[model samples]
Target: MATVAHEILSHIYSRIVSPQVKELRKYTAFSNNVYGELLPTFVSRIFKELELSSHQVFFDLGSGVGNCVLQAALETGCESYGCEIMENAAELADKQAVEFQERLKLWGIKAGSVTLITGDFLKIEEIGEILKKTNLVLVNNYAFDAELNGNLVNMFLDLREGTKIVSLKSFVPPGHNITAHNVESPINLLKVDEREFFTGSVSWTDAPGKYYISTIDRSRITKFLNSQE
Candidate 1:
C-alpha cells in the first residue's frame, strides 16, 4: 500500500496538461479519444486486431497513466513495459505497474508484470537496453514527438525475429503523424506500423484525429532488434 501510494504520488508531480488528461494513452503513441481513463473502445479493438502473444514483449512509448502496459500484462501474459520521460508521468507509470502486478497476483491471473522507466526515449543508450527485452513496440499519434519516435522505431526495426514494432498514427495523417524529414521516404525512415481506422470518428489519435499504427516487421522482430547497428 505504501509503495503504491508513493508511486502514485510520483506521477502527480511530473505531468502538466492544458484541459484534461484524466485517462490512459493508447497505441504506440499513447493517444486517445474522449481522453480519459483508458482509451476508447476503438483503440482497444485495434490492439485486438494486432493479435500479440504472451512470450513477446510489449512496449508503450510516452505511456500516460500506464494503462496499455497494465492491459498488456493482464491480457497477454507477456512482459509489459512503458517508456516515459516526464519525471511525474514516469513515476505514475511505475506506480501503475506495481498496482497491476499486485492485482494479477491476487486474482491468480497468468499475466505478465510491467516495468516502467522514467527517462527520455531520445537517450539511445537507455532505450537500447529497454529494446533488449522488448518484442513489440507501440507508437501513439503524437506527431510532434516524431523525431524521438522515429529513432526508436528505426532502432526497433533493426532487430531480428520475435521483434515487432507498432507506431500509432492519427488517420488524418497531416495532424499528428510525424513528418518524414526528407522526401526519400515516409515509412522507409520511420518504419511506421500499418495504419488502422481504429475509431469511426476522426478523433482516433487524441484531439479528434484518425488513429493508425506504424507496425514493424513480425518475422524480423527479435533478429532486427538484436542486430541493431
Candidate 2:
C-alpha cells in the first residue's frame, strides 16, 4: 500500500508540481530559508513511522513548496497544514496546492483537507490553536539558527501530549537531564528519540544524516512534581 501511494505521489509531482516549480524559479529567487525538501518516499516513511491516520492532524513548519503537506494529505488522509514564510515559496505552494487538488480529482482519490499559509509560522494564530490537537509536525530545521529553533521550542510547548515532532535537528540534546533549577523547561515535557536516514532521503545532501522525533510527553514533568511533593 505504501509503495502504491509513493508511485501515485511521484506521478502527481511529475505531472502537476515539477512544471509549476520550474516556471516559478524562472521569475523568483528562493531565500536561504527555503532550502531543503523531504522527498516523497521519505515523507511516506515518516507518515508510517508517526502512525498518521485519517483522524490525525499533520503540520509542516517552514513547508517549502508544500510537497510534504500534499503527500501527507494523500497518503494518510489526515488534515494537513503548511506554513511558509518566504513569499516566493509560499506563492508556489499555493499554485501547487490548487493543482494538487485538481490532480487528486482526476485520479479519483479522496484526500484530507490541505491548508497552506503564507507568513511567519510563529506569528500565525491559527497554527497555535491547531497545535493543540496536532498529531504530528515536521520541521526541516537543518539550516535554522539557534534563535529560530529556540522560538520553535517555545511554540511547541503548547502542543498536546503525545504529539510527535520530526525534525532534521534535535530540539533536546542527547541525555538531557531534568534538574530542579530547570524543571519547568519545555524539554522536560518531551521524550526525544533519534534515527538515521541514508543518502537521498532529503534534498539538501547526498550523505547520510540523523533526524529526531520528539514526542510530547509531560509525564516526566508530572513525575518530577510528584517527587517534590
Candidate 3:
C-alpha cells in the first residue's frame, strides 16, 4: 500500500515543479547539467552494490536536489543526509527531502528519514561529528572528476571508522607520476589505512561519454582522511 502510494506521488511529482528550487533554476539558465531524474534501474543497481543497511545512516556527497539520499533511505531503510554546496541546490534538496518523506508516509513507509546540508563537504563546520553517526557515503563519481575529488575523499575518510565509501570516479591519470602523487601525498601526511579500488568505464548523463570509475579501497583512503583531520 505504501509503495503504491509513493509511486503515485512520485509519478505526479515528475510532472510538477520538482527540481525547480529558486537557486537551482538559475544554474540551468547558464549551464545545463541539471538532471531532474535519472534512470531508476541504474540507480537501484548502484544502491544495491553500495550495501547500505536499512537501520544505518547514509550520506550523499554533492547531492544535487537530494534525490540519491531520498532514494537510498526510502528504498534501503537508512536515514538519509544530503550535502550540497550551492545555496539554491540545497534549498531544492531540502524541498525534495520533505516531499519525499511526506510521500513515503502517505504510502505507509516508516522509520526511514532524510536531511539536507548546504555547504562545502570538505569544510562543513563540525561535519565530522555528524558523520560519526553515519555508516555509508556515496560519491556521485562524475560530480567530482579530478578536481575537488581528492579533497572530498580525504574528508570522507576522516568520518566514522567503519564508514564505507562508494564513489563513481571518471578520471584515469595519463602518467604513473600522477598515480604516484596520489599515493605519496597521503603517506607523506602520516595517514594510512586499507585501500582498494576498481576501475571501469561507463556513460552518464553528466559526462555524456564513457569514462573510468576508479574505486578506492578504505585502507588507503583512510590514511588520507585521517591526515586531513
Candidate 4:
C-alpha cells in the first residue's frame, strides 16, 4: 500500500510538472551537468538501508523536485528538508509539496514534515545547524564540480557525531593532495566509514548508474588525539 502511494505521487508529479522543467535545463549546462530524477525504487532501497525513523531529521541536498524528501517524509514520518538551486525545480517542488500536504489524509502520512528551499545550499546561514540535527543527509552530487564538492565536504565537517551522509559520488577521490591543501584529510575532520555500490535508475535514463554511500566517522577525532599521545 505504501509503495502504491509512492508510485502514485511520482506519477502525479511527472505528469503535471515534469515537462516544464525543460526551460530549466539551460541552467545545468553551465555546470556541465543535468538535473536527473532518481527512481522511487532506488530511494526506497536507500531509506531501507539507513533505517530512518520519525525521531530523525532527513535532508536532501541538491534535491531536484523533492522526490526523495517527500518519500522520506512518507516512509519514516521524519522531518524532511530539500534544497535545490534551480528556481523552476524549486517552484515545482513547492507546488507539489502543497499537493502532498493536501493529500496527507488519504496517504496516511503526517503533515508539516517536508520543506523545499530554493537557493544555493551553501549560502543558507542555518545549514550547519540544520545538518547537525540531521540523522541522514543525502546528496546527488554526480554532476557537482570539484569546488562545490570540496565545499560540501567542508560543510560535512560541521555535522554532529555519527551523522550519516550518502552521496552518489566520492567527495574525496583516491590520492587526493592533502599536502598541497594543508589539511590533514581531504574532508578535514570527517572520515569515510564504509562505502557500498549500487546500480539504479536516474532521471529519464533507462540505464542504471553506480552510486556510493558514505558516513562521517566521529571517532576520527579520538583516533587523532590518541595518535598525538
lDDT winner among the candidates?
A: 2
The models' CA-based lDDT, in order, is 0.52, 0.84, 0.57, 0.75
The residue-by-residue lDDT of candidate 2 on 48-131, one tens digit each, is: 888999999999999978889988988899999999987777877887788787777787888899999999998989889988
lDDT of 4 by residue, 1-229 (tens): 3576577577658765677766657574648246777777778777788887888999999887788888888877889999998877788788788777767766565633897888888999777778889989999887788889888888887787777787877775655433434445636454454444445456645665566666676565555556667
> For candidate 4, which ten residues in a row score worst on lDDT?
177-186
Flag clash pairs in model 2: none
TM-score to true structure, per model: 0.60, 0.91, 0.66, 0.86
Off by over 4 Å in 1: 1-40, 124-126, 161-163, 170-209, 215-229
How many steric clashes does model 4 contain? 0
Q: What lDDT, from 0 to 1, does candidate 2 have?
A: 0.84
Query: Each model's number of backbone clashes?
Result: 36, 0, 15, 0
Off by over 4 Å in 2: 15-34
